[model samples]
Target: MTTQQDIPGRTVYIVSDGTGITAEALARSVLSQFNLTFSRIHIPFVDTLDKVRQAKDQIQAEREKTGQLPIVFSTLVIPELVTELRKADALHLDVIQTFVEPLRAELGISPKEEIGLSHQNMESLEYKKRIEAINFTLEHDDGQSNRNLEDADVILVGVSRSGKTPTSLYLAMQYGLKVANYPLIPEDFERGHMPKALQPYKNKLFGLTIQPERLAEVRNERRPNSRYAALDNCRYEISEAEGMMNLENIRYLSSTSKSIEEIATAILSNLRSY
Candidate 1:
């Protein structure tokens, strides 16, 4: 059995240790288990012996300053590398990687069994290709196939800089939805109405707009130094486009400065509420 003693104030170096994001997430989760407050240093991508030694030297310097030996926990550790790190002379240290050896004794599961379980989980995933195909058809069918937009789980319409592609992609990927996105062109804006293509699907259609400055920034990243990316042009186009959406009493979301996860989750929440 491994025992961890309480230290009032200690620092920990949570090395990615080749486990990448998964290791960092684990470290964040375990932070509440200890009574003591500590600083967490994330050392990412520790792949070799040289990297391990460098990490030890860094911890060595920190320990010397703090007068408390740092607790080093890593997702990757080998016996030979462990021997090298211990010689660095840090104090009151706990190396948690060595505790993994008890997994076979406690879990009573083999590596092959674990692998098989993962494979089985993946295999059970339902066929989603049909859903994707339906979505793609809506976006690219060019009005030739005459697919019914009313049947879509969600419909998206906005001027070009709006959050259509990403939001539609998220809905399709996450909820197995048939999604369609249509760009409101200048003519549609001038007409002060929903695009004819979207008129029939008015009930399912959604709009995404952005602050002109934010819209310009997003466009500039894709096409720098062009009229499409110019701030004033973005402002004019966005105002006209939004005015058109409003003329029809269409509802919209402001997508500027929101993360993909936030947008997707918000869209899902709205759909669920309806």
Candidate 2:
């Protein structure tokens, strides 16, 4: 129960023997429960003694500067590297060994202390599926091409900048789901239907909408002082889009406050329920 008041100069160090993606993700998930802001430093590829020592030195420096122990989240696979990292004057969270040792004991087998194994299986069928899904999603993004619309696992419909593209890509990359997204413009609303390209894939459609104010802010960054970025227009488009989705019986979610991960997970859960 680390509180905001208890943490002075909150800094977090994510150290890993390979890419620090896992460590950083775990750290963020854990830190999210706390009410504190933290400056995150990622020290990746700490596979050797020298690299470990350097990471430790950085952690130590942060602790000295802040007068508070910097929280470290480490996924070092090698025992020696983990040992070295422990020398730093910081709270060390061994992200890997915590689960590894338990699993090793339960299975009664020695763990292969490998580095970057999680992402090294590029030749696996799952990896190939992810690659194909990514390519398919990219090709079908923003209603660009509908050559194989039936092949998509999900079709996203929303007003522009409602978080369609990134959500599509995340579904593809993370779950190997081939996703296609289309923007619901004024023409589609005037026509009183979804885009013709997406009509046949009605069951696959998932809609995303954003709050008018947020949509205006997002659009303004791209096209400042334009009617396209106006709050009134945003409200109109969102209203039309929601109406169309409801008319078509398509499921929809608001992306105004949800992260891309949360939106994708919700979409996947909806898809699974079908």
Candidate 3:
């Protein structure tokens, strides 16, 4: 019955012998289940016994200062370092050991105790795919080129400042999706049709619209007091773009109250449906 109100804050130490990205990600994913606030301290590159000792000292000092056993989530592959860390006065959670031991037993093989092995393989085909997808997304951004719409895994269409650019980049970099994005301008509305380049590849198109107030606010920050950033203009563009999307039967979502991650995830879910 540990309600959020009972704990004002809890300290979490993310200790890793490498970049610490994996440890931090694991800690955050677990912490998100609870509603309590957390103060995170990342201790990366804890590769040596001296470094582990230093990390142990820091964890002990924090526990003494806060009068609470700080939660330590570590991805230390070195047995000696893990042993030293376990002696510290804290709730030590071994991220690698927990999973690796089970895997070793199940597979009957000793796991390689190497650091950064997952990401260190830069010459990997998966890594190359990500790089190529990123490059394709950059080249096709904002309808910059019409030659490769067919090559895009997904194409995002939105009015000005509705988060078309960032979402496309995220899809490309994270999912290895060759994403292209196009802006829906006033001229396109006046023409009363979809862009000729996008007509054939309509299935790949995803529409994004935002609330007028939010769009206006975003535009105003970039170009203040102009007609382009006006509330009326934003409202008009959103309405027209949404109407066109509906008429064309394209899948669309509002980015008004969504973060980039939420928006990207929803887009991916929509893609899977097709």
Best by TM-score: 3
lDDT of 3 by residue, 1-274 (tens): 3445536667899999998898898899999997778899999999899999999999999878877788999999978889999888999999999999999999999988876676735789988999999999999999899877788999999897999999999999889999999999999999977788899999999999999999999999999999999999999999999999999999999998898989999999988988
Tell me the TM-score of each prediction against the true structure: 0.55, 0.86, 0.87
Model 1: how far residue 186 lies from native, Å: 0.9
Worst 10 residues of 2 by lDDT: 1-10
Ranking by lDDT: 2, 3, 1
The residue pairs found clashing in candidate 1 are none
Of models 2 and 3, which has the larger TM-score? 3
Better of 1 and 3 by TM-score: 3
Number of the predicted model whose lDDT against the real structure is largest: 2
Better of 1 and 2 by lDDT: 2
Error of 2 at 256 (Å): 1.5
lDDT of 2 at 160: 94
- Per-residue lDDT over 124-229 for candidate 2, one digit per residue giving the tens place of the 0 to 100 score: 9999999999999999998899898989999998999999999999999999999998999999999999988787888999999999999999999999989999
Cα deviation at 250, candidate 1, in Å, is 2.2
Compute the lDDT for candidate 1. 0.67
